[model samples]
Target: MSLRGKIGAGAIALASTPLILFLGTWEGTGQNIVYGDKLARGLPTVCKGLTEHTSPYPLVIGDFWSDARCAEVESLVIRKGQLALADCLTNQQIGQNTFDALSSHAHNVGTSNTCASRAVGLINAGHLAEGCKALAWAPNGTTPVWAYVTDAAGQKHFVPGLHSRRRAEARLCIQ
Candidate 1:
């Protein structure tokens, strides 16, 4: 082609690379955080805090009313689905601790202004399924994720992940 055509192509190619990378990292782009750093920062902090000072739950709910994005995560609890909640958050740390503070905070049943009820409801029931469904259907080129549990009879109940895939088994879990 002409010299101008070659320069234009080169410029387009160079501009696209960083744009792609930035989009990959942004939550507003596709919110690609499946089950690690992203979730940890949001829900884990909420759960841990409410679990600790039960008295502060009302305050928390009122203060952060706009952050419903984490309501599903707050629902991870002991009474509803303790084993799986623990399993999902196992070995997660918040500084020098292995998130025991968060775990301890989870056990108190105050029903105050905190997330214990939601967490319990999610764990015991399949409540997170809706959020899971929403996350799974969002189109951002994200891989599907799911959690599963094996029954005594060896049947596997698949937990829905962020993306929707027909037959991918990488999301198998034993919880």
Candidate 2:
């Protein structure tokens, strides 16, 4: 093969490596984790963070079920045969706006920078891996903040099982 062709092939291989590895090992589907960072966590907003939107949403990024729904149902859990109860929200604001936010994400799972897009964005940016590696406090709470990530398909995902961010960095280098 020509030298140019070889270089191009090599570049392609390198680019695909992470993606191949990621898709094969991505943990942000179905099973989700929660972190301690509050701000970084899922906030009630338009579908996946859209600037212009309509409708209501439910389910925060981290499985924050709505309080009222929880009360009406007399339980924090909600399941509808095939669909597991996924809307668990804290903070009245998050709870109140969840219906809209989740609906919005449910609205666009494959287009734009909606929730799914944010999930992809975070992963591509290495935030998911980085946060997972930086898990602080074992996700048992007490940590300053916690984080959770919903995948491109709106599956619940998290960066839970945290320790100190510094300690996590040390593990990376030592290993």
Candidate 3:
């Protein structure tokens, strides 16, 4: 039977390892230092893309966190994302790689958007591989989504970094 509701402990544990590594690779550790997100136009962000909104505390410029502290916060954030993701997922018995990829995508985007995403909808409809591909492209299969950054001028620009990350997640999802 397809599992639903909250993600089980075993699945969480299995996905956590690769999810963490994947996040570190894409988000970067930021050397445990807070910096402004250029895409967000000076929004302060810390290790592994932790912003004031997501961080336990309000992030300020130049704030520093130890590596251990960064890891702790990253774990907390990922756990929260996983929980929210579980609520949206109709089938919780997905593979570890797929879970990790979805969790990573949810971490980058918000859980709400991830939940309402075409990828999730496709996954729920049992189109597993298609759902994975939807991470990089829209339903039309050519238009890129989640691969843009808003600038200070309120204009959106395509970001190669985001495209690369999404493609990586899609690859992991299908593995």
lDDT of each: 0.28, 0.27, 0.81
Backbone clashes under 3 angstroms, per model: 12, 31, 0
Model 1, runs deviating above 4 Å: 1-49, 53-62, 78-81, 84-175
Error of 3 at 21 (Å): 0.9
How far out, in Å, is residue 142 in model 2? 21
RMSD of 2: 17.9
lDDT of 3: 0.81
Q: Model 3 over residues 58-88: C-alpha lDDT tens digits?
A: 7879888898888888888777777768777
Decreasing TM-score order of the candidates: 3, 2, 1
Best lDDT goes to which candidate? 3
Cα lDDT of model 1 by residue, 23-63, tens digit = 12322332312222222233322322233232233333224
Best by TM-score: 3
lDDT of 1: 0.28
lDDT string for model 2 (1-175, tens) is 4222333454212112332222223212222222222322333332112111321234344454343433232111111100110212111221212222222222222123323333223323545433333222233334433234455566655554322322332233123
TM-score of each: 0.15, 0.18, 0.91
